[model samples]
Target: MSKVALVTGVGRRIGIAAAIAERLGNDGWDIAFNYWQPYDERMPWGRDAESRAELVRRLDRAGVRSLAVEADLEDAGAAEAIFERVGAELGAVGALVLSHAESVDSGLLDTTVESFDRHFAVNTRASWLLIREFGRRFTGEHGSGRVIALTSDHTVGNLPYGASKGALDRITLAAAHELAQLGITANVINPGPVDTGWMGPELIDTMVGLTPLGRLGTPADVANLAGFLCSPEGGWINGQLLYSNGGAK
Candidate 1:
């Protein structure tokens, strides 16, 4: 049986999640990806069902089995539902890519408790639950399992989003220390300010100027790092925040 990889937040064809899924498929891994349609519809950069279907079709053409699961990570039962679907449709998951995040922008002054909770539920809580389930179901008889989460280190205007990702970072590192005996490796990636239709013209120009590489980061840039981290050579790299940004400090 082909190894299975589960990637979350693949609601659009041009996003980072789609890139990661496609890269993994090309690498000979069956894919099980999760998306929240309603959430995507409400985002500033809305997504349609056809774009998602097109992504799945493209992955299918890569000659790997693919399963697209609609799940709301904010729901308490969402993690189990995702794993159950993957286990039934594909085989045991050998790798997990957590690219889904709540990107609601609220500065420290305007951030509300409800927004904070909601952000934590999706960004931090859901990731921990999924990791717990993945670790629970992984059988160490094979080589090893991989867990990679995408995060941001921003501090202002993204209070809830940034803080929640910080929580996810801690959870990932703890899993790395505790789950190593079971042949599991955990790491986080910070892909810094990729324009996935969320930024306006002014913001885009500002970000481009700030980037030392003289160009905005692309989904493919992040996907390349994700592919490498899940590969056999990446087994030795764990518990570290791998920055794929082009020297954007």
Candidate 2:
């Protein structure tokens, strides 16, 4: 099997996507990551230009090849472009980790049409397109292809983001069967309440109190599971939504 992986939404060093990329690189997989700075800049936790560069340096120091592609997943053509660039730069991707999202806190009564459409375009449509490209271009050995997506179930105040992620879950799980001929295992992971610089002090305390582990989930926690799922040992765990949420109720 080719030891190449494509990880999306790696725009921040503290983000889950960056952690997953680093973990896979440490596991000896050549890493190709996609990021959009504009998304981070607009978010409450602004962008860190140096962090992106530092992540690439870290991957390079791991003795594995690393490529960073700046992509706006909202563009319909970005999926194919990412695959083409990664294939030419590294090799055919054997594992795909989708950690990107278009999240904005808007309730059902307040969510606008534009916001809803953008959420689906990035979270749902882009995922489908990327997976489709992966299935079409995959040349890995039988039972070598892997697909994993990060998901959420928090929908009370975050309507569009949560709803689109639900669609993403279905689209990803379907690949486990639809792409079975290509020997791919697909699954969704709901890594609940990972702070990743988004939660405040009070929210952190509340989350810790709620979790059975007495602490909020970290990016590394999710990364560990993702790395395992991409390994050969994870081939049997397919078409399921596994929660790595520190037993948060």
Candidate 1 lDDT, 30-84, residue by residue in tens: 9999999888888877766686678778888999889989899999899998898
For model 2, the superposed segments whose C-alpha errors exceed 4 Å read none
| Candidate 2 per-residue C-alpha lDDT over 6-104 given as tens digits, one digit per residue, 9 for 90 to 100 | 999998999999999999999999999999999999999998888678988999899999999999999999999999999998999999999999999
Model 1 TM-score on a 0 to 1 scale: 0.97
Looking at model 2, the pairs that clash are: none
Per-candidate local distance difference test:
0.89, 0.95
TM-score winner: 2
Q: After superposition on all CA atoms, what RMSD does each candidate show versus the true structure?
A: 1.2, 0.8
* Candidate 2 worst ten-residue window by lDDT: 47-56
